[model samples]
Structure formats: structure tokens, C-alpha cells
Target: MSLIELHTRSLELAAELIDTVQPEQLVLPTPCADWSLRRLMEHVVGQHRGFAAAARGAGPDRALWRDAPVGADPGGAFRGSAAELTAAFTAAAGTPGRSRLWLPEIRDGGPFPLDLAVGFHLLDTLVHAWDVAAALGPSSAAGIAAAVEAEPPLAGALLAVAEVVPAAPADRGPGRAFAPGRAPATAAGSFGRALALLGRDPDWAPPAR
Candidate 1:
């Protein structure tokens, strides 16, 4: 499958997970340190818009990267942003000089290739979808996410990317791409190992609520 296909799948998975979030659960903490589930979602929605802008050569503008408010319908907001990104990326794939476009929000906004730009978003969607699932804990939402992860194509693509991303450095914390690495459990599957590579514990559950 294409990177766009994988990215779109991740976004869809994220939307489904978001749809399962209860109103009271919005304030719950997520794997991203210091960010509640709502706050983490704010960043995810903002990132979708920012990346969409970048695909169209307008990414240098910082305003698009601003944290958006989690409105009354978080799932709706997530789907909207995901759709925007999907359209932008589809359009960008055909646009002339797309390879020259840059994504400013990534590592000092270097002039990375278009494929890398999409890959970045794909990776974010994969990890953050897991974050949402983990926040929801052992529920229908998590089961939904786990079922999707069991698909070889999706997990394989994510694993391919995760394996290449180096473990987070000692200074790792909020604002960095990933957290400190954790050892994968002996019984871990491909998806579990992938999460481990991305500095998340597959067995993690929310604190007593």
C-alpha cells in the first residue's frame, strides 16, 4: 500500500478511537507527558492542519500550527482535520514541484522530501492513535485499535517506520518526538514491539480513575 493509504488508514483509526471517547474521559492523562487526552487531541488536530498546509507549500506560516480548541464534538473535529489532510496530501501527490515543499513544524522546518513529510504524519497518527487507545484502556476503543493493529499491512508499515526511528535521547520529554525507550515484553507481538520502539509500553494502562 502507498504511504498515503497507510496514512489515511491511521487517520481513520484515530477518528474511530476519538469517537469512542466519553466526555468525562477528555480530561484523562495520555501517554504524552503533561497532556491530557483532550490536550493531546488538540495537538493532533493542529498537526493535521499544519501538515495539510505544508503539502500545499504554505507550511512556513506558523498560525496553522497553533493548538486548536477541542470543540464540543472532538470526534467531528478530528474527522474534519483528517479529511483536510487527506485531500491536501492527495492533491500534493499530483502537484508540480511537490518534492520541493517543506514542513516547518518538523525539526526546525527543514526542506525534507515530500515522502518524508507524509511519513512524519503517518508516524504521528500511528503513535497518537495508540495513545488514544491507551487512554481509553481495556475497552471497546482499545479493542478496535488492537484489531486494526493485527492487520499485517498497517502494522508492517508502522513497524517499518518505527524501527528506523532512533530511540529518544536522554533529554527526551514533552515537546520531543518520543519518550524514553522501554524494553519489549517477551510475549509482545509486532504491534507491541512497534510501540516499544516508539517509546510506549504496550501493556500500559491508565491510573485508577
Candidate 2:
């Protein structure tokens, strides 16, 4: 599948997980330490908008990257952002040189290629969808399935652009996007292996209330 297709699938999976979030679960802790579900949603929305702006040739403006406000209607807010992101990506497809993306923190350097930017975001969406599922606990069967379904396509897309993605450094520091988590056992399926590669424990569940 194309990067755009993978991104679309990832967004759909993310939306599925977001839709399952109970109001009370907003404050729950996720695999991403220090970020509650609510905060994580905000971050997701922010990233969607930021990437949309980048695809539009408007550099990754810091203002566009600002965390979205997770109001009482978090799901609605996220859906809106996701829709905008999809539209922007669709419009930018096949027009690589038309715009430049500003990604200062890129492992290789600044100013990322259009395809690389899109692929990186696709990878992030897939992993974060799983993060949401893990936070929601085992009862979210539908969410879990959606996340699992997204893994292969997104991971394949990432591999297509792996050269741009920075390897996880030895130090699992706060700023790092992924830590070097323990490798998944061979028995772990594609989804589980993808999560493990992204530094997430596939079996992670929320603490009992």
C-alpha cells in the first residue's frame, strides 16, 4: 500500500480507539509515561494539524504544533483534526517537490522529504493507536483489533522510508520518541512485533482501578 493509504488506515484505527475512550478514562495513564489519555489525544491532534500544515508548505510552524484543547468532546475534536489531515495529505500526494517540510529534529538533518515525513507520521499513528488500546484495557476488543489491523501496512510503509527514521539511541531518555524496549519473542504476531520495535510492550494493560 502507498504511504497515504497507510496513513489513512492508521488514522481510521486511531479514530476507532479514540471513539472507545470513556469520559472517565481521559485521565488514565498510557504507555507513554507522563502523558494521560487526554494529553495524548491532544498531542495526536496537534501532530495531525502540524503535518497537514507541513504538507501545505507552511513549515512545521510551532503554533500549528500546539496541543489541541481536549474539550468535553474529545472525540469530535480528534475526528475533525483527522479529517483535515487526510485532506491535506491527499492534496499533497504526487506533488513532492511543490512543498518542503520543516523537521528540525530529523535524525539525518533538517528539512525532511515529503514521503519521509508522511511515512514517519504513519508509523507514529499506528504505534499510538496501540498505545490508546493498551491504556483502554482488555475490554476494548474492537479498538485492539483496529490497531492490530493497522500495524502491517503502516510498518511496511515505514520500512519503505526507513533511511530517514532515526534509530533509537542507547539512552532511553525523555526526549526520545522510542526507547529500546525488550525484543518481542518470536511467537509474537506482526502487531506485537511492531509494537515491540516501537518500544511498546504489546501486553501492557492499564492498572486495575
Evaluated with TM-score, which candidate comes out highest?
A: 1
Task: Give candidate 1's root-mean-square deviation (CA, Å).
Answer: 2.0
lDDT of all the models against the reference? 0.78, 0.71
Q: Over the stretch 1-209, how does candidate 2's per-residue lDDT look in tens digits?
A: 77678778778777877886778889988988788999988888888888888777776457877788877667788889989988887787757574457754344334776677777787778677777777887566335644454566665564444333445474454777776655876876555555666667666666667
Model 1, range 1-209, lDDT digits (tens) per residue? 88888889888877877887777889888877778989988998999888888887785777978878777678989999899999999998998887655666666677777777787788788788888887877574357557666777887777777777756474355667787767887976667777777788666666765
Task: Tell how far residue 91 is off in model 2, in angstroms.
Answer: 1.6
After superposition, the stretches of candidate 2 with alpha carbons farther than 4 Å from their true spots are: 94-96, 105-109, 139-155, 158-164, 168-171, 207-209
Off by over 4 Å in 1: 140-145, 168-171
TM-score of 2: 0.84
Indicate which candidate wins on lDDT. 1
